[model samples]
Target: MNNIKIKKNFSPKTYLHKYVYDDIRPIIKKKRKKVKSCDFKIVEPENYKNIVCINYNVNQLKQMCKRYKLKVSGNKSELMYRIYNFLKYSYYCIKIQKNYRGYLYRQYEKFKGPGYKNTKLCCNKTDFLLFEEIKNLPKKQLFTYKDKDGFIYGFDICSLWNLIYLNKETKNPYNRNQFPEDMLYKIKRIVHIGNIYNYDINIEVDKSDLDILSNKKKIELKTLEIFQKIDKFGHITNISWFLNLSKIKLFSFLRELIDIWNYRAQITMETKKNIFPPSGSPFNNINFMILRHKKIEYIQEKMLRLINRLITYGKNEEYCKLGALYILGALTMVNNNAANALPWLYDSFMIVS
Candidate 1:
């Protein structure tokens, strides 16, 4: 946006103990003055006629927008923040905003008290997953019709051998500075655990947790060890890589694109359903952990609620494991409740989500 810059020195700005993401209310809230209106004609409670937005009205916001030539299409919250940005920063950064209340509170220790110790969202566990950084494949290249040997080479995949990366520039470098928001490609959560969209799995994980992944479903990390294709002229025709992972799933956004006049990201089939992950063998059961909170009600974790409803209400075992012919999940809510509350709740998974 021409008028605003939310990032300072290649990093997101923090205001009011919260990360500013197109929302400037926190800054304004911090600056709000509790002033009393100096009017004898009308008796009022403290700060009845303050200039701050603590006492807000639609007309005031509109007037501010008109006076500043700001866009008037946003909701009141958006407009309030926009005007605040204009007044304070003299610019308006219009980015997709995410809810950071939970995170900010945790950072500030808002949830810490005598009753609560080792809480899930309030703390970070030491045992987080550690993902190996798979090198990014080279930027796609067009097929060379003829090489020095006069042999035809229409693709280049062989150079994938030296999969070592000294420094890289394939994916957006600074985007992680804005993680879980500006996602290019990431593995969704599987095995009934974690947020489906959380790709921040590059940390070291516990071995027991790793076993859960292996038992549920794994592409076998060994399979990703060797991947290469050389053209007839000893030229690199195509390249492939595992860009990032969420536990078991290794995800790559773009493969070495094959240039057939234009470019199309290649998906070499280990089998027919080349791009999509194949389903595990049938009759494999999926179960979640169930536990009771200290002297509190029992709450089951994972999809127990849904599974129970489907089982009892539907009235059939077949319905319990019915046709998803292929379960393609775009959005999933795999949360932990009291039932699955291990000594550590999802190992601070809820907070990460």
Candidate 2:
């Protein structure tokens, strides 16, 4: 009877498990520390050198082209040439697609995905009294684009904000005749987060509920009051009254802001280990091919910071100097000037090694 009692006491419910001591480990989440720019040093070029065509085999080149959905049939040089441009394009077009922290996998996600801030569209609901959500919309939301002429059509088409319009069947929900001449806008609404996906827009007659022209700007302030919430980054996509060209033009302008924001390498992104955080600017990256023959400084006013290391030699400047020269050589190779660029790259490798 004592043995039975001892066994019952030793059961899982009563006994301690090994997991209590063995499995539980405190997760040490290392916070990112900001590295100062003065600490930047020349490092190995191996990380970026892999991009050069000379590093890859013919089969690898063909595989890369295939992955990018490009035409894979070509000579080794041709394959390398095509892959080079595509890689450059992919790098420069940062916002187009990616799964990394600052990227979108699908091109369409630029509109649907979150992290986009637009004052007029998302935060300012009072700007338009029209029903936004499908639950509020009388009909289902369709993906479509409309023109200034007030036509409802889409290309293979369709996210229309179903604004109630006065037609033969339906009466004006907010009588248009009573609306001031300056208040009524036959504007086209592009239902997007930041960028235009599907190359389509939803055009309809948008009505303004302003009692007078002077109170037009009050809608934004009133929107915050009504919701009891303020937009996080309304200024990110807000346009001044001077930029009020046309609705379509305004949409184009908004999309431009998205590109500018994404391509800009963020300052805070750099941890203590890195000072020059942004790899390179979009301007320099895209123009490197054409600037192969030109001097680095002649390429752009905002040239690579590493380029200065070539002139300002320091004790730890080997990494910076190597990177600058390696980039110049890489850019030269992309322009089909391998004969001239090869020597510099080889010398860079020898020096760095």
Candidate 3:
């Protein structure tokens, strides 16, 4: 038997050059640069094909094929190709269909009678009456009424108020009238009577009493009145009246309002899903067992504005700074932008530190 001998000589540099530099180096340096750049431009169809082919497992590709009713009996590459073609063809078909429908609609509109062309034809007259009634009603009565039907009426008061407010704010009458009455009425109401403090109006706050009331107490009083008026009526036609109040008073009122809002939110989250709290729940007064997103958003906006104002013009620099940080931390629970909030946070921190 002839013995065969193989020479073994291993060099770290040679090994590294071949395996690390040649094979693995490019991958190490390779990165998804677009992600770091935060490039969110619409993805190209070709790029989608590559993503599906490279990242998807065989079963996922097969599942997608089944979902789109395409043939599933192919290797990964073939499956990917089929999926790409199907998506492309489906997209084009949808585009063409939409374009054709739009064209036909335009032609119909161009040839139709004046009455048919009027978008107001689709507007619900009853909803319009409700909107007008809501707008015309006393602000004090908008939110406070009990509906005979047990179903809370005028819940869309907030939306209607917003539309009206927006129209007036922008000086655009056309936009105000453009909405269908039903659509306008469907907008969520913002003010909740249950959240407002109850104060005896007959027991007036004299100047001396006002001087003695703590900031929190003053806020409770003002917010109580504001919410009462909102509940009684569907809208606040002249917020300028409230704005005329001292800035400190307004700021204190907003701070208290935010605290009340947070408490309500906690109660809302703790309540059983779809199961209304006992008739005794504080929410029952608002006729809402669950707090709506629109209302929450409105409160959040107010809190953000109040916090900003406190940071800008508050007397107690330390408190304002700490409050800004506190508000930023609290709002993160509600999924607000912490990065954008950092400026106020830093400003407050610098002022105090």
Candidate 4:
């Protein structure tokens, strides 16, 4: 008997490009401005738009052809002509009338708040002074940097590590500017790293209550009081700080913390279920009594709510975590909700895989 070869499903290397193009294509077509007949000049090799102009880079053009399942064996000009013609035809044929309104509505819903604008609050001088204050802090003191106005800044260890790495990599040896552009770039990149971590996390940085003149000593005292109330644990010894970092960093830190909490919650739930069985026998009244326990019921409800929140507000990576949570029965008594969980688990799997 001949064995059948099972084909493995894998994403094409151009998936990111294709996904982005497909997403923006509808909006582009709907908002396309009317052009005169004179505007339809022959697309020269040098004159084509960046999106469609590929002939200039022979290797890139060939890769694009292969990505689109087109004839890859062609001269640079020939490949460019083929890509240009394909894009031109596609541009003309785009019809989003039926779906354009819905797309716009969805976008409006997604970004109904302050939107993705990067607002500048304090001047460069204030930022430079703040950086100077915190930059020379010892490793232990790096996590907590209190500013004036009683604001105690904290940072994620992971993000701090990345920032340190970037600083070492791009340290300007010759120039000694107070706030170098390269250092600023590193800081901004650290914050923006959250977008790569999760999508639902807001990218906006809130600076409504920042004060540069508030006594750092008072802020440190208040932070110490707060920390006293909260018991220290791994990574929890210092709370994630948001001051001075861009919107991306703030959101990424929050998302990372939430994910960590979710993981802990899952482990706690599994341990509780294993140690204390809610069901023992089909005819036992004690099994029913165990389900009625307030502590068990409370934990289950919290787990359900946390998982739902992660599913609703989490990014692609969070979705993957949610899928694992559901499949592994992270919440005890998930059998009752397994029907609903299956769809979410499958959806997350498809997205991540």
Candidate 5:
């Protein structure tokens, strides 16, 4: 048996080359993040180092030629290069020629999808025309340009979303456990409480009135007064006014006031948490830090002090008004200077008479 002699040749240069290639290849490796559910396949170039030609889906190539202000027929390679350059320069991320082809394919796919995403109409159309007009217009005509009056004319779309989004506050009335009468009384208490602070607002209920006409007329008059106040001064203001008055005649105003206060309180809470869109000004790139625990602790201390004062001299005419004022003031501070605060304070002071 003749044994075949085999030579195992391992060289230092071969090992060194392997290591160098491994280290350097990573620098030139594909960088694009893998896009999910992309319609186009990435086809790599065989001859050129980093170039690729993309075969279009249907009339996509024709569309591309049209897009770059070119005729749809002939000079295919030049049109392809134009498309490549457009993507590379415009997006700034599509550096490789293959990346440009893949992007165009993806955009074409998206344009043809059920809901066209990121696809702009041609410059001739109404939407695009209007956009161009706005873009070229002087800064004075624009809504929120820095050179303009700094007033944004449009609604905060997010705010409108929140305002109309949900009806979470409407409690279920059909539940056997939920007593409508009890809820009604609680609402009535809130009304009474408000009226005690604002004596002038209360409806006049004469003890001498036994006639049905007089009683009916008194109720009607009181209802009109409350409605008028609500129309003039908003819910929170009316509630504060009611709370400040003496409980003279609050028939239906009390219910409306309670509902309004509850709504406002919820709104204030939402605003503080940034759950609701801002009602004031446009958001700017401003930075500020607030220590939440520190603020809450400080406010809690003030609230406790006010509660103690209210408990101590709530009955005495002189101190009663003062205590009410203090409580309202503290609540106002806790609510972050909400607009309703002043009304509450004013109503409390009105009952000093």
Candidate 6:
């Protein structure tokens, strides 16, 4: 297999150009915008005006292709040929083959199109995994910065490390910045979490989050401690992580994420209008607390009604499962209805198909 080298020193403008040409141009085309361009803003994930992608890291993508006897020969013709061969070889179902063929063509087109500016897409989860892998790998020969955590940071830890490496060897760093949108989404999620869990993990000045990541020994120990605490609580084990959690099984994770956010944002997640007392506040007013709790109850009930309607007569199974889970989630948070939601949530889990 041919391998691409990753360069250490790249002009920031040139670096940005590579990404626009290599990644963005193929998917989106726009009038060439200046460096301080206002052409592309990262698209919000909630907006469904464009394509939706399921992601696994580049390594995983390669592995899957290999498993199916497919190859990603750098050239588009080769890639198309391989995709066509795979379509013919794997499935007799005409519909499935057509879908695969169509998907491949669109992906290929996006990979090869002219760069657009000012628009962002949904983050690709696979890209985050790939970025993590690149960050862990040895630094390429270049200027390296050490943080307060005593870990080195360098350009080797890019979101599109593979593309960078390929660009270096080919002397064509065109697709360098076409970071999968899902990776950006993860950053958003993490930032949101950080904003909420801001007090939980302190970033030492001169020590970035990447620094905390560098020491495997310390990270492992801390992770183990968190797992132990979760084990003791049992409640957290029931909570799902949004990224890793299945779409149908997202309610609990969404609920927890929102709750955590609420706690961080100093408000109730369900009743968005309500605010909680600041942490460690000396003021403990019972009447106010009662009123807030009642308001939350009302909101939860409203969500419950919506959820129940979607689940019982939902047109799609996935939507039904989502609704059921959310309904159960609403009940779980309230003081009284938590018990009632359990069996329903459990039943919904069984029906997920």
Candidate 5 has a TM-score of 0.17
Query: After superposition, which runs of candidate 3 have C-alpha atoms over 4 Å from their true positions?
Result: 1-54, 118-353
By TM-score, the best candidate is 2
Cα lDDT computed for each candidate against the true fold: 0.27, 0.32, 0.37, 0.35, 0.31, 0.33
Model 4: how far residue 127 lies from native, Å: 18
User: What's the TM-score of each model vs. the native?
Assistant: 0.15, 0.23, 0.21, 0.17, 0.17, 0.17
Q: For candidate 5, write residues 1-353 as lDDT tens digits.
A: 98854335746545433432222233333443332335543322222222123244324545655655545665544444434444434343334545755664454333222212212221111111122232333221111101122221211112112212221222211111222233223223323433443422222223353243343333333333432332332223222233222222121222222333334233253332232123211112111232233443333233233234332433344433333333343333323333254755534323243
Of the two candidates 3 and 5, the one with more favorable lDDT, higher being better, is 3
Q: Candidate 6: lDDT of 7?
A: 63
User: Which candidate ranks first by lDDT, i.e. highest?
Assistant: 3
Q: Which has the higher TM-score value, candidate number 1 or candidate number 3?
A: 3
Tens-digit per-residue lDDT, 1-353, candidate 1: 56754445453334422444345444455445332344212211232222234635556667667776878777777766666655543322222112343443343232112112322221111111122211121112111112233322221111111111211212211111112221112111111112223322222334575566542222222111111111211222111212122212211110111121012212133321221224311212322121212111111112222222222332233332221101101001121222142213223212232
Candidate 6 overall Cα lDDT vs. reference? 0.33
- Taking every candidate in turn, the Cα RMSD to the unseen true structure, in Å, is 27.6, 38.1, 29.3, 27.1, 27.3, 28.7
How well does candidate 4 match the true structure in TM-score terms?
0.17
How many pairs of residues collide in each model?
18, 14, 12, 5, 13, 26
Which sections of candidate 6 miss by over 4 Å?
1-143, 148-151, 154-240, 255-353
Clashes counted in candidate 1 amount to 18
lDDT of 3 by residue, 264-311 (tens): 224243332212222212222231223233343333345334444433
Better of 2 and 3 by TM-score: 2
Off by over 4 Å in 5: 1-63, 67-77, 89-353
* C-alpha-based local distance difference test score of model 3: 0.37
Off by over 4 Å in 1: 1-22, 25-53, 91-353
